[model samples]
Target: MQEMKAEIATKNSKKANLLDHNSLKHILDESVSEIVTSRGYAEDVRMSNVRLFIGTIIIVIALFAQFYKKKFPGNRDFLIGCIVLYIVFNVILQLISYTKEKNAIMFTYPPPGSVTSTGLVVSSKLPRFSDLYTLSIVSADPKSISAGKPVEFTKSVTQWFTKDGVLVEGLFWKDVGALIDDYAAVPKKKK
Candidate 1:
């Protein structure tokens, strides 16, 4: 009878162990899912911000151009040229943002190390402006590259700003990574 009782106790312990293992697995799976979803969301936010920033700059330029044209009606040709240039510049910018947005949407399940073609790097540390400029030099001048080309200048600038911002805020590397990720994952509406 004692031996039977021992056997039963061992079986119960084994069952408990199995349950614990399953529970632990479940918790781990949940944590992983949360992290992935959060990262994706952050990326989306960052992309959106990029779109907004670019859009805002284009709008500001357009407004300024309009102001200039109004202030100098005599140079109609120059004003028209400025307006055309602004429109072309913005259209190209929108196209780039659209492409990035499409890429982000297409990759619904990005692996942890999945390198984005857009050079979206999330860092918990912000580098200085000079550091950013150095990186930009290494990445090549984005401004020099045609607007239609897949350039890394914006990404370099973003990385630089992110590094600087994090340092100023005295945030941790992980927090900086999260911030950068958020910046890159900005929401973009359909063109």
Candidate 2:
């Protein structure tokens, strides 16, 4: 884990040349893709499991109702109740999935100065819905990197996507890049 963190930090540091607006925008764009793809994929897998579990429970209840129909004359009422409950459960699941997709946050390492103990968090609102997303960066103490301790947040940066995960493609990048450049320019005290 430490090795991977070190490698990531090295790579980010190398890519800290925020003077080039194009490069910075490209990096942010790439990060958005990474965040969405990874988080979306995980959400897909989890929702699939939840759906399967719900289906299994519904089937088991149905089977029980069918097998005990003669012993329990109330089987018809019980089965109808189960069916209604199944429908309600399915609707609830759909709502849950939609909520998750809209609000899920994927944390990843940001370029240089954007680093934080919790790193960067990316989330989407889905283009068809509102075509917006929130990208939050929390600045951390450089010394925490070496100490393997949680860093303190000295600053924060928040950017939003105008269309899905894509930025407005103008001064936004410059503003964001300037902040990161300023942060990265800060000298760290040696432990």
Candidate 3:
């Protein structure tokens, strides 16, 4: 009986040791995974910040070039070159901005209703024209409107047009409303 008790105690001790070791290993693994995940997120945020900072600097430089062109109108070639370079830089910056924003939206928001040949169309409880315009700008493709026929603008090439809040009125609000209505009417498939 004494020998049997000793054997049982020894077995229990070994079992306890193994359980403790497994528990410790599990804790360590969880901690390491958390640290790795946090580091990855931090790196992503840092990269985004760097991109935004660089874009801002480029835009500022572009604005300075515009100012210089205005200050020296006689140098037409230099002015034109600066303007072209500025536009190119601006387009690059906008592209980067759009990509980042799209990624964020995709990650945070629910999946869009359906992705057509053009782009994603989201269904909303309340649809507004301003919202549609903003969406069009974000989507960056005028061809995304897959619904009703848009009112054909039949103005001459020389016709001057401006936004409502601007110095001159351009396209009518009714036209914009129609465009939005058409966009909202686009068919969407279930996810």
Per-residue lDDT value at 66 in model 3: 63
Please provide, for model 3 over 10-100, each residue's C-alpha lDDT reduced to its tens digit, 9 standing for 90 to 100. 5543121222333333332233223323322111244357667777867776776667644575767776776777778778767876654
Worst 10-residue lDDT window for candidate 1 reads 132-141
**Which has the better lDDT: candidate 2, or candidate 3?**
2
Ten contiguous residues minimizing lDDT sum, candidate 3: 123-132
Off by over 4 Å in 3: 1-43, 66-71, 103-191
Model 3 has an lDDT value of: 0.38
For residue 140, model 1's alpha carbon misses the true position, in angstroms, by 22
Residue 129 of model 3 has an lDDT of: 19
TM-score, one value per model: 0.31, 0.31, 0.29
Q: Tell me the spans in candidate 2 whose CA falls farther than 4 Å from its real position.
A: 1-52, 55-74, 103-121, 125-191
| Number of colliding residue pairs in model 3 | 0
List the candidates ranked by TM-score, beginning with the highest: 1, 2, 3
Clashes of each: 22, 0, 0
Clash total of candidate 1: 22
- What is the per-residue lDDT of model 2 for residues 94-169, given as tens digits with 9 covering 90 to 100? 7766764344344344344433342333332322322233343332233466212221122111243322233333
